[model samples]
Target: MPPDALELLSEKGSAERALTAALASFQEQVQAVPSLDLAAVVEAAKPAFSSGIAFSAQLVDVRGRHKLRVIVMHAGGAEVTSEEWADEVDDLLQAAGWMLAMLLGIPLAKQARPVEAEIAEAECLAVVGVPDASAGPEPSKKEDAAPVVDLDVALEPLTPQEIEATHQRILALPQASRQALTKAFREHFQVPRNARSIGDRITQHQHAAFIDHFLEECEEQSLDGAAAPAEP
Candidate 1:
């Protein structure tokens, strides 16, 4: 395909053709179930099957630059061979992923498709021209320009000691109490701002969850230990 045609297909302009063409290849295998809406079926299958999409998805590059993203959501097995028609398969999967996002009402911008990308090194740098101390019109004697300041900040990784201390604190807490804390943390700290860097947040939350679970287990054990006074 021409690069422009490929680019058009990648964008939303020719999405339907790209989508249908990609999905058509699977017609023989998935089989047209009577009265079954194919798009709806995929939507229903999403929660269970979407994670696999990433494994099958790839950013296809030509030379050092990205050309397209390819993903194959449904396959017979890990050994399904595509040696002969890999390009077709890649195109099909990419289109299908796009279609799935569309059918499920996911915004095009938020479609769960991998991106093939390329960036020029020169374009990546900041361009700052040297200041000319004498070129500008003279500053008014009555007015003062705002002060210019550059703020430099550094981010530090969590120290091992801090991690250990957090872990130990979680371990000391009852599981039930830990669960409560995790829930509170998730509700109070993580969800409000929609934080993207949730790994550390989850680690902290999980400590609370463990404590909650531990407490629940202890409570159950205590109940069990308490004699059922002459159960009727």
Candidate 2:
């Protein structure tokens, strides 16, 4: 864990309790709203300025606890035709991302917490423009007119290099060998994405709770060793 992460654990149990309450509270608020839709909100947000954009969200586990992470699809939308307009759009997206997190019961960084969002222009292309039929009849070539929205975000937990290295290590070993390692991991590892490092195969079998129990057992053993009498 990083230094900051260790500090974060100071409030771990309390934070989890808070998050559970927040999730319930936010869900009620969302259900009560007369008209609140993420997709619609995103669509409405597109034209306020000049950039083409998309949005999405996902759940992430931070130190064995579930957290909802926001992914802002497109980091920077189309070239900033206007610096002021671009800045405004950037602000809007950042706000929207946090707003979603608040609604979903997740606490993000005071700074910026970006995660992979499941958003993009269909077929892997940046959507170039919002639909505008005000000018005249809609063009037959729709792709050229409305750019597909792509929203993606990057966050910490594991880096690409680290993930790749873990994957490679798993792949190099036999399936049984890999499975055994993950079993041990499930029994002993308490780190984030360790089982995932090997591949989803391990994560599928290992629960975070199991890892927690293993850590407790290790701590008990360490304490026992420390209290033992010194032999001649």
Which predicted model would earn the best lDDT? Answer: 2
lDDT of 1 by residue, 1-232 (tens): 8999887655643443333333333321332112113353454435435323212434456665543332333232221111112343334443444333222222221122212111111111111111235536844411232222232211233343343334334323333333344444455444534221122343343333433443444444345434335458
Give the distance in Å from residue 71's predicted Cα in candidate 2 to where it truly belongs: 16
lDDT of 2 by residue, 1-232 (tens): 8999887776554544443443334323322121123444443344321222233554445666544344322222211110112222224344343344222322221222222111111111111122346646755544443222322222223342333233333333323333344555544444453112323222322232233333333334445545556689
CA error at residue 70 for candidate 1, angstroms? 19
Every model's TM-score: 0.20, 0.19
Error of 2 at 34 (Å): 47
Model 2 C-alpha RMSD vs. true structure (Å) is 27.0
lDDT of 2 at 121: 12
Residue pairs in collision within model 2: 73-151, 73-152, 74-151, 120-150, 121-149, 127-147, 127-148, 128-147
Model 1 scores a TM of: 0.20
